[model samples]
Target: MAEKGLVLLYTGNGKGKTTAALGLALRTAGHGQKIFMIQFMKGNPKYGEIQASKFIPNFTVVQKGRDTFVRKGNPEPVDLELAKEGLNLAKDILQKGEHDLVILDEINVAVDFGLLKEEDVEDLIKFKKPNTTLVLTGRYASEKLISIADMVSEVEEIKHHYKKGIPAQAGIEF
Candidate 1:
């Protein structure tokens, strides 16, 4: 474990927020470091990352939402419950300091969508171990998170293939 773990925040109205976190996870795995990714508002196991986890040693991906889309303004009761469950899992993982890298995928979006409270997440982050690198990925990151992070990257979507009638590719977008 490193002496000083970093708090990395990847956010913005863009495409690479989660991709950036996944890249770190890949690098961590390459170095034989353990990584645990808790995917919020994403339950589908068909995502490339989740499928790829089977072959990647020491990398785990867990999703905590239904397969269907979660309505932004009016999320279901299960959605709220799942988000809380994911948060609790994250807190336990952070406290244990088992993984070298811990990623809360789409956490910012979950907060922005009111699935999780910002204060709850802020409190959760306080439990991070000194040796565990923490990552938060999603759009609409709050100012408090950005201020507290050791590194923050906002992915700006200058252009997207979806706008040009191009569907998301399997490996590329998944």
Candidate 2:
């Protein structure tokens, strides 16, 4: 098997960015490779990562964001602190090199929102292990990140339930 490390950037203004990262984690885990996922800008527990954590031993999912979602026009100080903590944890994990694959879920959103600095991310990318695959997922990927990434995927939003007056559904949208 090939043992080359790669930077994967999943961006765009659409859904399934995190889902795609998680799918890669599951696939890697199936191959007996340990996977670690750090979630930024996410606090709710009613999601796929929580469900996967129950049965996947090799999968470690950590949510460092606030317990409540950050909404527009009313950002809380705690949200920023939580995002910082999460980013720090992710950096530590990336440096540890214990896992075969590390997924920085929704990290781009955190960076775009100014919760984490771009320089810090660039540093992390620089120090990643030679054989450790790193996957970053979120909308609005920065140009610097795209330049360093080995592969980039953009999810386009063409249509959605929100536009049709339908609320987000459990196990489908969540």
Candidate 3:
């Protein structure tokens, strides 16, 4: 068991938010710690992280949502259901102490899009185990979440190839 766990938040309007969390996942799994990732608002099987997690012993990645993008204020019913399901699973995993690290990938964006309530996310944190570090990633993190997190990192995008009309390539952006 861990001595203690931290609530880490990775947010901002830039790329690499999920990448950073997956990097942490790799580190945790490398240390022989069990890790679970609930990728909300992302359901692509071809993502490098998803494929890589398959090879990691203690790393489990579950993707929720469709390949299409969720509209800001017009999320579908299925989107809401998937996000809620992911949040519920995360809460259960955290409470059960089955994983040393739990990463809620793109959960901040789910909250921002109204697929989840900030209070629900708060409840998950409240039920977190002492030894389970919870990492929340994605853009538009709430102020309340930042206030409560033990560590917060915002990845700002100065420039990107996407802005240059370059498509998101596999292994790079998936």
Query: Over the stretch 72-122, how does candidate 3's per-residue lDDT look in tens digits?
Result: 899999999999889889878988998999999999999999999999999
Clashing pairs in 3: none
Give the Cα error of residue 44 in candidate 3, in Å.
1.1
Off by over 4 Å in 1: none
Give per-model TM-scores. 0.97, 0.93, 0.97
* Overall lDDT per candidate, in order of appearance: 0.94, 0.85, 0.92
Residue 130, candidate 3: alpha-carbon lDDT: 87
**Which structure is stronger by lDDT: 2 or 3?**
3
Error in Å for residue 47 of model 3:
1.0
Instruction: Give the CA lDDT, 0 to 100, for residue 133 in model 3.
Output: 94
RMSD of each: 1.3, 1.7, 1.3
RMSD of 3: 1.3
Model 2 lDDT per residue over 77-169, tens place: 887888888877878888888999999888888888778888888888876899999998888799999999999999999988799898878
Residues 1-174 of candidate 1 have per-residue lDDT tens digits of 437888999998889888899999999999999999999999989999999999999999999988888899799999999999999999999999999999999999999999999998899789998889999999999999999999999999899989999998989888
Error of 2 at 7 (Å): 0.4
Which is the winner by TM-score between candidate 2 and candidate 3? 3
